[model samples]
Target: MNRTLVRLLQAPSIILLLLWMIIPLSMTIYFSTIRYNLLYPERSGFIGLDNYRFFWTDPSFFPALTNTLVLVGSVLLITVVLGLAISILIDRPFKGRGIARVMLISPFFIMPTVSALVWKNMLMDPNNGLFAAFANALGMQPIEWLQDMPLFSIIIMVSWQWTPFAILIFMTSLQSQDKEQQEAATLDGAGFWSQFYNLTLPHLARPISIVILIQMIFHLAVFAEIFVTTSGGPGVQSTNLTYLIYIQSQQAFDVGVASAGGVFAIILANIVAIFLIRAVGKTLTV
Candidate 1:
């Protein structure tokens, strides 16, 4: 094939992808600068920074941001710790390890929406859910999990779905560990804890940072669980930035505010990405 033809063929795919991403992003930025309201679309004008100002001043915005941080941070912490312990355990050849691995990995394959529904209606529901049934049988009150603990419920739901992913990454990283180093440490009378902390953990530093950053990005955009379960309800108590923007655009029909919120999310994600890249650069050189 001619080089020009080959280049032309690849150009279409790149162009399509760019258009798919950039068009919507540009639209969002344009709307964020206007006063677009679905109910009164004709009245929309260049509001400049009014929508951004209102969104920031909204009392719910700060709480939602805090909740967003907590949701992402807590899940990241849990999944990393559990993923490390599980990876280490399974790295050892034990009986039935295959079965355990299957079970551990299966959760990541479940659709997020389906997992959210299962948790909302089956696991965490206060009425007739498994938890509620067991609590009622034990003569205890069925706590309103989604209502009283909306953010926590989301944390558990998202963690359940994503922990398997963390495990897979950690296990892949662990498999690359220097077994000779571990053996040498063992011969040196270094106990398991000391060896793990000194050798294994240091080896995992790059991957741990990778996992934390990647997972933070995904967790920041967590939507299905919060949407299907709480609908960002209990008075927006569980509304993370994603859900907050969703409610603004979909329910409240405030496209401008939603766009502004989206810009905020992009800014925050970039900030974390920069930190992660710097951390990776430093650790890789060391």
Candidate 2:
């Protein structure tokens, strides 16, 4: 009787959760199979697979896909490498260590839109920005970051925000590391690099995998940074898959194509998750 009551209590929340996820996904799939356009609601009807075909054939599709991959990969590399180094550096006891950690990790808590705006207006602006002022002081011309290097600028902004997250994870993991092993290595004439490679790296394997998985999931859907900074332009130069989908749905009013693109994004995310899951499993076993 108690078990039955417990099951009954759990059923509502589980059903609600299912409905929350299923409803939007079902609607997207249904929309993808039809000719739904906000601009032409009167002409909407069944158009099986046409939306997918149109989205796939879009000239910007491949470029958007490429940008998505590059952004994810570049940010992952930067965050993981820099996060590990920063975490290690701050892990040791020192003056103002707590304050330093707080300052270093604060960037991750900033809103993405706010961070992007700050980078665009305060740092990357060609004139009256920090980079421009520094360049002028040095008698060198300021480069147009958003115009000539839009994608790279986005990468740098994302990396700056996410590296703090990686550092937080790595720092926590380092706390649980086997100090005895580290002490033994040091006593046996192991230098800093040797100890890091042999002892610290192995201990951080799981945290690294977790950081990669989580960051990849978020980075694939990056929109605000690109939208706020570059608006996915200089002719789609900084357009990732998420921004491309936005253009289709909001700008072009093509719900069908946007839904198709959403479906593609879901598939891509799932593929990445599956691959990372397998890699994480391997790391766990090792």
The top-ranked prediction according to TM-score is 2
What value does the lDDT take at residue 3 in candidate 2?
95
What TM-score would every model get versus the actual structure? 0.91, 0.94
| Candidate 2 weakest lDDT stretch, 10 residues | 277-286
Judge candidate 1 at residue 230 and give its lDDT.
Answer: 90
Separate clash counts for every candidate: 0, 0
Residue 270 C-alpha lDDT in model 2: 97
lDDT of 2 at 194: 95
Against the true structure, candidate 2 has what lDDT?
Answer: 0.95
Candidates' C-alpha lDDT: 0.89, 0.95
| lDDT of candidate 1 over 1-286, digit per residue (tens) | 9999999999999999999989988998898989988987788789898889978988889989999999999999899999898889899888998899999999999998999999888888888799999999999999899989888999998888778888898888888888998999999999989998999899888888888998888888998888788988799789999888888889889999989888888888888889777877875753
